[model samples]
Target: MKDVYGEAIFDFYKGDHSVVLTTHNTYGEPEEMPVEVFFRDHQDFTELENLAITSCEGKILDVGAGAGAHALFMQAFEMDVTALENSPGCIETLKHSGMEKMVNQDFYAYESKYDTLLFMMNGLGIAGKLASLPFFFSHCKKLLNSGGQIILDSSDISYLYEEGVAKPNHYFGEIQYQYEYKGKKGEWFDWLYVDSKSLVQETKELDLHTEILMTDEYDQYLARVTGF
Candidate 1:
């Protein structure tokens, strides 16, 4: 976690969620890892950052609103916004930030509908597992307002590969990663990188249409919510 805002700014200092948390290395060695933390300050973000997301104004739900940056952006646009995060510590921070609009509820249990579902920063992994797409859609659908939209930002590692050049027969994810934290090189980072068309194809099965909302070379999609 970065030390800017929201991730670590809890009002009442409390204990952590009791999950058997541990960080691992590419070698699969275990190292103790601390919880991620963040903090929010209106002064940290520039004016351009505010303008980027404000263009979409409606009842917005900012999922995985790390540090409340996007939440602040939506609030500036005068839109009704609700920020939900799974971390209890992150929630406590937002609660005391004096922001009444933020909520700590999990999306699985959230009952309200939203016109806009804004997700960024690995939020596409809300399903947690690849096969959980249907499960994710089932729970997340309950929160969509009529004619709603899902704006998800994720990276397409396929873009990282040059065209026509065959990728390694082995999974690129198998090339383990090294983490240098707590004065050690550790932690294997293996997570799926959804291809641009893969998510589009998958979403279509659920009767939704996805398009490249914005992409320079990196592929991001504005997954439009349609039938079902």
Candidate 2:
């Protein structure tokens, strides 16, 4: 609840080049990744992110638009884009970085409809758990206009069990994460990383059509889902 991650992004934006993210996950030891807020441009984007951006059309909503990176990319093309983020500090950074439209609100409670809902950086993890997929789809249905599409990315995460390790009792993709910056630790939160096969099956039950847009060697993939 302290928005430690957002604070780090804001600090990096304010010229603190030493900011880094310390992430603790259920499946692994703590890892440190440098936070390069000011330097995140189109060149730093992955293939999946590029595919999603080029495929976007009409009005767009970039969910969890941290540092406004994806939204900024779309804005460069003069696309109608809104950067939606819940972090106040990140929102400040987004505004300072010249994001024309920024919203400080949760994606689930957002009511506007858009031609494209863009979720990058494993954005679908916001669904939290496999059991929440139905509700996630239902909410997305309400936020999409006619012929709209949801472009998002996530990893299979099955590689964690390749060493003959026992999987968690719940779904494999259901993960817990916490963030640490400096000497402070944030609260733990649930995140999901659904595989492509399971995503297709779940979408079918929701009456939505899913397409595997791209898959990399690392089991991370981008998917497009269209409402009925």
Best by TM-score: 2
Residue-by-residue lDDT tens digits, candidate 1, 15-36? 3433223445333456543333
Q: What's the lDDT for residue 220 in model 1?
A: 41
Count residue pairs with overlapping backbones in model 2.
0
Which digits, one per residue and each the tens of the lDDT, describe model 2 over residues 51-127? 98998889999999999888987898899999999999899999999999988998888899899998888899999
> In model 1, which regions exceed 4 Å deviation?
1-52, 158-192, 218-228
Q: lDDT for every model?
A: 0.57, 0.89
RMSD of each: 7.1, 1.3
